[model samples]
Target: MFSRAFSNPYISKWIVQGAGIIWFLGTFGLLMYYGVGQAVAIVDALIFALFFIFGVNIIDQTFNFYVPSGRNNSMLLIFPLLFSLVASYFHFQLLRWIFDEESLYLVFLREVFLLRWAVLGMAEILVALLALAVSKLEEQKEIKNREVMMHELSREAELSQLRQQLQPHFLFNSLNSISALTISQPQKAREMVLQLSDFLRGTMEKDHQQWVSLEEELTYLKMYLDIEHVRFGHRLEVVFDVTDEVKQLRLPQLLIQPLLENAIKHGLYGITEDVRIILRAYKEQNYLMVQIENPFDPEVAAPKGTGFGLSSVGRRLFLLFGRKDLLESKAVESVFTVILKIPQHK
Candidate 1:
């Protein structure tokens, strides 16, 4: 609490000003003690302290308008020296007028004139340097804040672009399927159209959301899978093995869809037999872990297309969590597996 109080600029400014006043009072009092006696010494100290405070105030206010930089910083010393000379002259004249009859005290004041002027000059220079440092610090803080904002905006834009790109990619494929089914299977194509409409509506709603519960995301994934089921029919099969404890945990919205899409594209495409894709989710230590497994025949050449789904998902994970190790994929014994780790923040 005490440290916080002192860190406040208003509190610190007043504390410094108070200390300066006390220093002027004590120094003047000691200087006048032996020559002028206690009664006159007190009065002399008070008057000189008032004049010193006024001079300090003038220096502070001047720096508020203009502070020297680069080659001009020599003005730090020059300004104080000039202010001290002027302040000392006025103080000396006032003291002489107030104590014209005290010859001993007048001699003492003259003797100490140079010392008082030097002390005031040094104090002013110190204050000027402090002001310059504060200005530079504020500038640096503002620049850092601006850089952070720009980075956030860039990340958000890229995420939006990825979302937009995924939608059209799926839409074009669905449209092709619908075109194929128009003459042969009109009823199933119409059903797929309705499912597509619902899935696109959910996507629009989730675009403004950053995170969603695992249960909600699974429901959204079910909608997407329904549309895919219409396209591939019984050849594509998906299994979910999610634990109840992890259903309430949150992950990035639409994070799982791309992985599932990739699995189906590689697993079922060009394969006549039924292919099974498994998705498992559970909590492990401080992370919500999810794993997807699918089988592919290595002997057959995979579909020729750009691999945007996996790359975009990986980029999104890195941007959100600042970790490259969150998403991992490996192919072993013709079985392709993807493991994703989401850190749980309490």
Candidate 2:
């Protein structure tokens, strides 16, 4: 109780101010009404202030213990009032010990102790209730803040699952390639099936994560490319030029794969000659830049894709980063290039 009363700045400040007021009143009243000497009156006031302050501090601690239990509200009031009355009686006895009991008999009989106890008790209860109300409001605000945070997390998870959905045509094409390879190249067909299985497993694992290290994402992409490489054979070639520093950086799961799929679909659908797909990842200034370029003959290849892959990637990037300029694409002659800039977080 003593520790809590002294540690609380609000309670401590009021107690100090109350003690000063008590000292001033006691010194002035004794000098005016009882014709006491200045030294004696001041000494008496000092002792009275110290003891009164101690009693008020103890009352504040007592109320603090009872305010939390709703069933103890009545007890909270009764206990402090009784304490004040007992303290007032003690103060009356102390004053008699300090001064002449015969001289101050009339003053003690005027019932000043009862009035002082009543006012002090009421003030103590009011301060305690106000502090309790403030504490309750703070707790309510924290609970509301936690609810808002949880709602946002659930929304993000739903959007992530949507973005991870596999395109139907991609699955159909892979299956057809596997069936054709099974006849003449059973070994390659078996290898492609294993690669496909690993790729899908990695995708499922990454779907549950918001972000993954660049190295892990690239490993999953490599498994996917192995399947596509077996389908196209020598006609498709992929080159990755990633910096060592960029490998540890992270980006949203499955973020880069859609861009590569679009490149392969638009760049090598009907072409016959060998074509190289180039991927470059590096840290540029404050952004992690990834660029993909592939060669496509406009005359031989079918019309460019419906833009769904790139559009979906862009939408997901905007949702994650809240920026439109992060994903960009441009085609110059026979070569199509796509660039993604992910902000580097400290």
- Per TM-score, the best of the predicted structures is 1
User: What overall lDDT goes with each candidate model?
Assistant: 0.83, 0.73
Per-residue lDDT tens digits of candidate 1, residues 89-179?
8888988898899898899889889987897788777766776677566668779999999999999898888878888988898899999
lDDT by residue for model 2 over 76-123, one digit each (tens)?
A: 577667766776677667767766544664374245667757755675
TM-score against truth, every candidate: 0.89, 0.63
Worst 10 residues of 2 by lDDT: 101-110
Q: The CA-based lDDT of model 2 is what?
A: 0.73
Supply candidate 2's per-residue lDDT for 196. Answer: 82
- For model 1 the local lDDT of residue 335 reads 93
